[model samples]
Target: MPQELEIKLTLEPAPADDAYRWLSSLPETSVGPTKRLANTYFDTPDASLNRLKAALRIRKAGDRYIQTLKTQGEFVAGAHRRLEWEWPLPSAVLDRDLLLATSLVDSVSLDELKPVFETNFERRILMLDDGKAVIECAFDRGEIVSGGQSVPLCEVEFELKSGQEDRLLYWASKLGEQVSFFINLISKAEQGYFLAGVHRPASLSAGAEPVSKLFHGLSRLWLTGELPQEYVEAVAELKAKETKTDWRTEIELFERLMAEPSSAKVSDLGKAQLALLRTGVADE
Candidate 1:
């Protein structure tokens, strides 16, 4: 059971091209050969795996096919951690014994699984090693196809091979200064699901009603250790508009919590305060 820790950033084609050039110029980066990957996602007709927050896919890299199963894990800011299991395949067929070894075996039948969407992308990888930490940076450019519909994919990812999670954010921020990029909470699988008409992507921006967004944004900032300035302003404006005095106290408590180390566990008081803040958002 390998846990993947990475930060995903969504970029436009022009920005992606600029970022690629910038990354290639860095002396410390070791660039790997570009490879084309074709991935097909599978699920039962009613999408039992999707409902369970699990994903199954087989990726074809040249002449080799690899099968993978990933279960959704915690996501903070742009950092995503997921439990992944992978195996090499002799052909494009699913391995029944391998499927039976996992939790999905009980819930899904191997025969019922079918391809729902496909992602074809060309990936260029770059590596940075500082003795203690190794980060693999990937630039993916391609399209996701499903039901005769397709969406272009242009993004950069920083995957922590062995290092502190903060290092990934540090490099992301450094590169972000040269090129504009936004954190993408949705994964490629989620995007494919949305395009397949299963469900909509989760909202990332604060809308006209800012209370709920403020609370959610603050929660992510506290958990991920990456706070966007817009979220801070939104929280301030929402507090000013409200007459409740307790909301101000709750905001202050959250600010203090945000300043703590990422390894710090949330105290009982903090949990209660968070619950109160969520209740306030719901009441609004």
Candidate 2:
């Protein structure tokens, strides 16, 4: 429920391959069916600012669903560490609301731990739909409450199917690994957004640039209650172009503009200004 670490790791290039060998390599010991999932995301130009997103995710083990109003963040790019937190209330799909937090640690690349976590053995027969396999190793850091209630104390997951959970363990075990990392929902979603380097608006302090103030400053001339007409127009146009835009690039531009000495970073102001440009037209 509070702030915590959420991370992900995506294969540099994803590959879809056969499951027979990996499955056969498993011990007779049994486990339930584990589905393969692919998610495609759609977002407005200010997705990072709004902390909002829409996506279509399908898993081989279940039906596809529409995911709306999702939020994501990135700690850095490609050094293979990321974080994410999401609310269960799907803005458009399903019923009820859930809260989750998670992170992914690409232990494979840690130089300090490399003596045990590194791997070099290659396989050419693996069936990767695109010649790349992604492994999303995640962790959830929650707290344990009293009264015998075992709340999620944060969870870590290894989300690669190219190898069975057992095979993954083999590699990890060889490296003297002792931590328990299971695959789960919170971790998976975290991985998806981390791979994309999602943005987050800077949290301003008292006497600093408040987000609301930024919006007010930018929309001064077109001021209106709640949302100015210009702001509404910008949101509408942004929504229309969301599916086709490169959200990350736009996020960078927004961050740059707002960081300028005399710039305004208000929500309405950002919308209105972006609406007049070709870039932010898709930013809702």
Candidate 3:
């Protein structure tokens, strides 16, 4: 079981080429060979896997196919940590025996799985070695196809190959100076689901169990100045059923913070709100 620690930044399709050029020009960057990746995502008709915040995909590179299962974990302030398991496949098809060996064995059956969407992308990778840390920066450009409709995929990702997570963030900030990008919380798999008109289940949990997770997830979106409508609705629904006064107050403050206009830079007020959420008190 390997943990992937990375940050994904979304960019406009038009500026993606220039951003790649700038990335390749960095003196400390070591360029890796580019490859085209074709991936097919699978799930049950009702999306039993997505409701669990898990993704199942088989990626084809040349004649080699690899199956991957990724379970969602903590994501905060542009950083993501997730559980990932990958296995080499003899062919492009899903291996039922192998699938049964993992965590998804009981939740979904082999006969129920079907291809819902696909993503095709050309990836250009760059490695930055600053003596103490190694960061692999990947620029992916392509489109996600579902039901004959396509959505452009233009984003840059920084994965910590080795070293502290702070080093990854430092380089991400430095690259931000050259490219205008937004910290994207949505993953390619999630985008595909959205394109397929599959909505997220409102049943996050039955009771107060979902509060902490919602708080952290929404707080990260606030920090990045992103307020997706689904997130807004989720918080509203959660707050309505919450029993704890302190947690309900936190949710209300978060809503108020999101309602206010956000500046180009991370606002002082936004920082204050995040601090308050973390410490249960506003910083002086």
Best-matching candidate per lDDT: 1
Model 3 reaches what TM-score against the true structure?
0.75
lDDT for each residue of candidate 1 in 107-127, tens digit (9 for 90 to 100): 887789999999999998989
- lDDT pick, better of 2 and 3: 3
The prediction achieving the highest TM-score against the true structure is 3
Which of 1 and 2 is ahead in lDDT?
A: 1
lDDT of 1 at 87: 95
Off by over 4 Å in 1: 201-284
CA lDDT, candidate 3, residue 262: 53
Lowest-scoring 10 consecutive residues by lDDT in candidate 1?
264-273
What are the Cα lDDT values of the candidates?
0.71, 0.28, 0.70
Rank the candidate models, highest lDDT first.
Answer: 1, 3, 2
Which 10 consecutive residues of model 2 have the lowest summed lDDT? 113-122
